[model samples]
Target: MAAFVLRTHDYRTISRCLESYGLAVERSAATWPQRRFTDAAERRRAVATVTALGEDPAGTESAGYFHTRLHLAR
Candidate 1:
């Protein structure tokens, strides 16, 4: 697994880079049914679920984070 820090976090930007590198990217669907919770406990639980899926919590304040894996031909 190779990890690279991207200068931009836009999906289109990432796609363009992958194309330039001749790499095919398979994107996973985002976790759904996100509900705004009034209780802190509920929010924590939802954040935990997102974390388990390797995604940042929706409540996070920052953006432009990208993580991807590339497959190699044998």
Candidate 2:
């Protein structure tokens, strides 16, 4: 499974058809953001399907940002 991230603004306008694949809206107040996915092929189809449904690529994300520390200051 794989999770893709997109801008919050774009997710707001995602089409319902695309939601069938995987649509989990993130709460603005959430302390930790999480994502879920079925598999690689599934996610691929989801992306393709969304485009077929006429959903803008910009608004295809259904999850929020996950906290990750790429750089740790000593």
Candidate 3:
């Protein structure tokens, strides 16, 4: 599966990116949000969307394990 590290500051951009990929938000975390894809095409689209948004995509072998990091400017 594909994973990504998205910054909180870019949440909106990422959300838009994911929407572009046709993946709906499945859940959210305190620092990260999770997205589920219905198929491989959606997964690829999600990865591309996040990558285009400048987030680093990390591919993992773990089932239902997508992790991301969030940062806030002080």
Candidate 4:
């Protein structure tokens, strides 16, 4: 099972990325949202693909999918 404990903003970005790739990303309604990749190979592939897209400046991701500005303490 693949689970990610990240900021809601980050998860939304990742969800969009996964959906754009036509991958079914399931989410849990629990306190902490959960995502699972049942197949090891598929899991790795998805991670790799998403990582690459996140690093691309040409895409909506624009070199990073994370929105850390909000997480920083003012």
Q: Pick the candidate with the highest lDDT.
A: 3
On residues 9-73, what C-alpha lDDT tens digit does candidate 2 reach at each position? 23334434345557543323212233444576655655555456554333232332222111111
Model 1: per-residue Cα lDDT over 1-74, one tens digit each: 23332212225565667667777655444322323455666556545654665566543412212223233211
Which tens-of-lDDT digit does each residue in 1-74 have in candidate 4? 24443322346566567677777666543222134445666445544654554522222222233212121111
Best by TM-score: 3
Off by over 4 Å in 2: 1-35, 59-74
lDDT of each: 0.42, 0.36, 0.48, 0.41
Residues 7-72 of candidate 3 have per-residue lDDT tens digits of 313466655667677766443333354555567765666666656766555652122224455422
Off by over 4 Å in 4: 7-9, 32-74
TM-score of each: 0.32, 0.31, 0.38, 0.33
Q: Show pairs that collide, candidate 2.
A: 10-59
Alpha carbon deviation, residue 60, candidate 1 (Å): 5.5
CA lDDT for candidate 1: 0.42
Give the per-residue Cα lDDT of candidate 1 at 71.
30
Candidate 1 weakest ten by summed lDDT: 61-70
Task: Score residue 36 of candidate 2 by CA lDDT.
Answer: 41
Candidate rank order under lDDT: 3, 1, 4, 2
Error of 4 at 70 (Å): 21
